[model samples]
Target: MQSNHDGKKPGLPEIVEILAVSVCFTYISGGEAVGAVGLLIAYATLRWGRS
Candidate 1:
């Protein structure tokens, strides 16, 4: 049987959920440019980590 906490990283849906929240908060608190930069940075970090 598979365990719930098998030490696996979050899947795409989970990552997207997090990204959505982060972007929303940043956009509301900061602005469009800041939100865009934050998204770019997040995407870069995820890609870098995957490689």
Candidate 2:
């Protein structure tokens, strides 16, 4: 199965948005230290990838 079956699409960064939101939500909903760290890492990844 090819990764792109539809038209052109934004790839990894767009997918990371979902992960980032998930991490943030987990952190907000009482997730522990690991979850918080995940959230922080998500932000850093997004920022780093954007630039």
Candidate 3:
């Protein structure tokens, strides 16, 4: 089983992953929607993890 531990920090890998998914979601468009969704996802994950 996985240990109950969190990552040391949000690094380049996390950012790259967010960007990759955002790009996939907004494939042919470039706008704040992608940024908002990405940030929303990040925030949601953070809050969810703590709770």
Candidate 4:
């Protein structure tokens, strides 16, 4: 069966938004390393959801 999605990848704006939020949380939590890991997980989740 074929999917109905347009197959368009996420744009720069979406990525920037994710990065901005991640950095903000990192600053708030005072742990750059943990924040970076969380960012990667969040980005991966977003990509997986899109696909």
> Which pairs, if any, clash in model 1?
none
- lDDT by residue (tens digit), candidate 1, 1-51: 433434467678657866786777667757676767677567646753442
Global fold similarity of model 4 (TM-score): 0.48
Model 2 lDDT at residue 11: 74
Question: What local distance difference test score does each model get?
Answer: 0.63, 0.63, 0.59, 0.67
lDDT per residue, candidate 3, 1-51, as tens digits? 443337555557666766676665565445568666876577648743533
What would the C-alpha RMSD of candidate 1 be, to one decimal place?
A: 6.3
lDDT of 4 by residue, 1-51 (tens): 433435666567657867786777677768777877677677757754736
lDDT-superior candidate, 1 or 3:
1
Best by lDDT: 4
Q: After superposition, how far is residue 44 of candidate 3 from its true place, in Å?
A: 6.3
Ranking by TM-score, best first?
Answer: 4, 3, 1, 2
TM-score of 2: 0.37
**What would the TM-scores of all predictions be?**
0.42, 0.37, 0.43, 0.48
What C-alpha lDDT, on a 0 to 100 scale, does residue 22 get in candidate 4?
A: 74
Q: What is the lDDT of residue 26 in candidate 3?
A: 61
Between candidates 3 and 4, name the one with more favorable lDDT: 4
Task: Count steric clashes of candidate 2.
Answer: 0
